[model samples]
Target: MARSGNVWSRAGVALFQLAEYLHEPGASVGYTLANWNISFGGSVAMGAHRSSLREPSMVAAGVLAVDIIDGNGNIRHIQRDESSDEWLADSCPSGITTCTV
Candidate 1:
């Protein structure tokens, strides 16, 4: 969490929890998914999202980085600006990774 009300979480965190956390007095996510039961990692891997012309398709725009567990069971730290992960973040859902933000 930050002074600006921006909060970051690990992949295990569920959207429901995030929604609740973001529900501070006057804060909310720019984009929201109807089903809040999904895990952050699941959302990212499946590219879950909602369409919007003004706002982004998903909350992925807010993600700074992701540490994904590759097929080999190794943790891969991918930054938002990396070409491939950039595509992943834009094309994928929103926030994700394994244990860390």
Candidate 2:
């Protein structure tokens, strides 16, 4: 029983460490700003999530979309509409440049 408890404890600790590492600021798998105008400062994954809320479609003119990776190690388009300005404004700060759409 004591041995089992030790094994469980070690496993829990290992899992916790793994989670912490995954959540760490620099541990992301990819990164990108929906709009190129926004500057990013972190691992690729962190940058992607942070920039995903900006006026990607308006700035990029439909080129800026969600970040996704495909089996070929390439980023796939996630698609964003020009009409989502409200949601983008809500997610991004006011100082950010608004989409003219």
My TM-score estimates for the predictions, one after another, are 0.63, 0.17
Candidate 1 residue pairs in backbone clash: 60-94
Clash number for candidate 1: 1
What are the per-residue Cα lDDT tens digits for candidate 1 across 6-92? 466885888777767777754665566646788765665566665677866765655667676666777777767746744454436
Instruction: Show how many residue pairs clash in every candidate, following the order shown.
Output: 1, 3
Give all candidates' CA lDDT scores.
0.62, 0.33
User: Could you give candidate 2's per-residue lDDT for residues 70-90 as a string of tens digits?
Assistant: 556675444445477533432
Cand. 2 TM to true fold: 0.17
Instruction: Give the clashing residue pairs of candidate 2, or none.
Output: 30-44, 30-45, 31-44
Error at 2, model 2, angstroms:
66
Q: Judging by TM-score against the true structure, name the best candidate.
A: 1
Best by lDDT: 1
